[model samples]
Target chain A: MDLPSRIVITEEGPREGFQIEPGPITTADKIALIDALSVTGLSQIQVASFVNPKHVPGWADAELVVAGFAPRVGVSYTALWFNDSGLQRALAFRGKLTLAGFISLSASEPFALRNLNRDRAGQIEAMQNYARLHWQAGVPIAKIIVMAAFGCNFGGDVPAAKVVETVSDGLSIAREAGIEVREVSLADSMGWATPRRVAAAVGAVRDRWEDLRIALHLHDTRGQGIACAYEGLRLGVTAFDAAVAGLGGCPFAGQPGAPGNIATEELALLCEEMGIATGLDIEALIEAGRLAERIVGRRLPSAALRSGTLASLRRKVGP
Target chain B: MDLPSRIVITEEGPREGFQIEPGPITTADKIALIDALSVTGLSQIQVASFVNPKHVPGWADAELVVAGFAPRVGVSYTALWFNDSGLQRALAFRGKLTLAGFISLSASEPFALRNLNRDRAGQIEAMQNYARLHWQAGVPIAKIIVMAAFGCNFGGDVPAAKVVETVSDGLSIAREAGIEVREVSLADSMGWATPRRVAAAVGAVRDRWEDLRIALHLHDTRGQGIACAYEGLRLGVTAFDAAVAGLGGCPFAGQPGAPGNIATEELALLCEEMGIATGLDIEALIEAGRLAERIVGRRLPSAALRSGTLASLRRKVGP
Candidate 1:
């Protein structure tokens, strides 16, 4: 019941969806969705991922998408990049986007090996070099991201200790580079997180680093995303990473056609209904979800987009 | 968190799915689904709905479905009906099914008007007749169903008082019929339930009648069904009604393509993950969900079915 009065959502639909979708989704369409999400009172939006086009052909037009979309005044636009080459591309648009480096590590070693082609030591070495590059380029390492924080397809149930160890690895890398990170995003990359697992992982992380603000990057792959979000809220975790219309899928999780991220429209509804202000328009978010569906030329996994928000229903029903 | 040690799941996939599908679904397909659900360690299954063939042509073969499926030992198979004709139809299969009448009333009058064509007063009168018929036919009015107990499309926000009043009205009808109903099921008929609203309605009913067992009939229309169910679980509510693979939709809710009940597989996962025994085989349930998708000739709304179960993941990862 210790729900936060307000929660911050990082809109990841554009970045996540376009990266995994098997599409020649026009550059204009990608810009259109990001522009649509920009007006929904979202404080932050991940507009594109600067990954190699050979790996993810969907995000090939990343530069066009970033340069094309209209960025709002209050919204902090962000982008995802793994290596220095990707980072340099993102750094090209410094003012247009809020650039920060992430010490991203996978909680499960097997998951890291499959997705990143790196073992535990190899991942740490990569991040150590990544941290130094960010330092030399003067980009702040804002957070430590532990992928597969809950469980994994390759390694199965990830103990909270594994998450802590991952974070510790990230922290050591940050320390070597003389950088301080305050936030940690626990990602359910394989969609294996339940509420109980969320509680355990969040609790374990908090027990180790009491001052580090926690963020959940949950997937709806098994449909427990919102419930897991609810559990996080109960624990007073304020930051979440979500996709509008549930845009993103784990390309490396070995689950195809399973849902991607939790829907931002539904998560916002869950918050607003419980009297927790999301500071976003529910109707507008639903419309954006519909727009996302149209862009992808298929219905996304979000049921809320179909049923609509309660605000509209209340208006129809009257007082 | 006073979670129930064990919970009961009533598999309503056959009845709920077949009723709403615009299907020329064969009677054989329907029985095959029921038979699949029977071996999944479920204790109760709602096999079919006996309604007018002219209105709901999908369930025209309800008689054949009930007669066709091989009932497993220790499993209680049930059927739904609104009037005496439907009840008489169910009575035809006395030994084949567990026959119990439900005093189903809508908490919202306008919702009742749209769905049942009965106002608050008219609904009471109809249920009075319903109870008497069940008594005469040797069927116990086992529970009072409060539909739209959280909120409704036609009727805005249903207050806790309204739900209590609906339950009170049902109790009076049962008392008049000399029936002692022990259970009250609060249904999110149009999927307007949040955890807070569930707590309110569930608390209101329990405050008035602490002795009665509470059951939740949650729909995943807006994707908050599992979260609401988690809230119910925390409140020690033990019984849930679910559709395998999220097979049903509200035909009268003015919502097209919206998901119906929460998928039984996901709900069972939620319970089992929380250490609440559901006595359900998670793997078998996932298989049933897939079978449901195949029978419907389309992908159902359940993400868990596609992702499979954690038990499989554990096995894959090994101990």
Candidate 2:
């Protein structure tokens, strides 16, 4: 199948990428990375997370980072908010920030408790309450991120039925709360998804939420992230979440093992080769990788930066 | 779709894996690795190459290595022969080797000159003449590998029509020469193949040769090997060529750039998790990885070994 003509990229380096680092990043570095990413032609950037500071100290200065950036005209700066309390924090800057609320429902009771510190039902209730509060406060939830939609770390294979049910539950809550979710994203939280599984999940969600814009947030832990993205692109998913330099790993998902999410440069290369216009500057993306590496005080996991692309290799060795 | 019932893994650690290393590996260590691999339930092993000693000094003692462990029930020991001359060398040790001849036909004039020192036509003619000679000598060419079937460094995007025409040509030549070709493999010499391209190529070949058993030899240079394998598996392919600990490279293809074929342990894990049986002992495979690292005097590229599997990780970290 031919690739899509225009593919939208959502840089997750500021939010998801920094959240999984070993130590907290200073607000200045976070803002610098996001500001650099804004000029890289990304359609959207997950700028920060509004989760509890204690839970994710790396994102403690999320508000400052969001306030610091000079937002680009076409690029949307998004922040992730978890529950009613997080939504309240997001609402304080709702008119000034593009907010994205995350809700995960794939885990069973035990896994949910371990990962989210709540049962599945409790998590669902928390999302419902957040949706109601956002509606009453006139806040726009830019995207509803469905985490672990493909599979869970503790729970082996998340059934497609459960994912469909969770989307349905979220839709019902949104309808009752009188809030319209602008887009929905399916995340392969633990990187346990295959291409076929990703296709099936995306297809199921799209079938239910026909009008909701779909995005895919994939982790490359098992080296299948690009493949999964290819499949998603084939299934008409144009937006994706990627970390610059492939920095970051899930503290819970990749505790002592596991690889991380797909790198932004690698993903852009894939799209570029397939004739998909991602509008990302490969050279600039590599520079962003260097900036990320400097902040982290070590090399990131980007293979494209470490090992140049095929086109670059061809040029370096001469024709 | 459910994964196939079983996957046939052809371990190429002994020959391809060691060929590109900087230092020399002792004949004893090579033999020990082959023996260790045998118990890991590999269906077949490319034990050694019968290339000229000048070309690859590492396999200069290929004859002795084959003689050391020739008789093994149920596991085929295939040796790679480059041309009619290498086929002659292989025939001398026919009593102790299961032979397979390799012919690369995916490159245009320039790349063919640099990679195989022969153009596409010259390579095909060499294979046809070698088939005739092998038939006369009563040597069974168990497999015929067509390298660079996906894409070539100098010549990009190997046309699917070219691959089909070349395979048909080789099959005709073998039939007329009274030599039976048991299997044929298509390799991604520069690792430039995507899943879509792979599916298209494999599907085209399958359409033409319904009776021919097909295998894929893929490199992970661009991290698409596993995804390509998954696509081929969905297309009903049973056999694959892999380098244990992911050790191998094609210097002519690109330097410090050409990654090895997909790791055997990763393939086994994918098959096992998808409900396919490879009969491979994952733990034993990790042991082989350790031995490979020691032999190569560096870290092997096997992800399963570096980052332990979920089961092994749990065991290492204690429940």
Q: Report the lDDT tens digits of candidate 1 across residue range B1-319.
A: 6788999999999999898888889999999899999999999999989999998999899999999999999999999999999999999999999999899999999998987898989999999999999989989877999999998899898899999999999999999999999999999969999999988988999999999999999999999999999999988899999999999988888898999999999999988877999999988999988988889888899999878888788898887
Candidate 1 CAPRI-style tier: high
Residue-level lDDT tens digits of model 2 in B30-127? 88889888888887888888888898898898888887864567787888876667777777776566665553454345566776687767777777
Interface RMSD after interface superposition, each candidate = 0.8, 3.9
lDDT of 1 by residue, A1-319 (tens): 7789999999999999988887769999999998999899999999988989898889888899999999889999999898999999999999999999788999999888988899999999999999999999999997999999998898988899999999989988999999999999999968889888999999999999999999999999988999999999999999999999989899997788899999999999999999999999978988999999998988899999999998898888776
> Cα miss at B188, model 2 (Å)?
0.8
**Candidate 2 per-residue lDDT over residues A229-259, each given as its tens digit:** 8778777788888888777666777543345
TM-score for candidate 2, please give it: 0.86
Best by lDDT: 1
* Among all candidates shown, the one with the greatest TM-score: 1
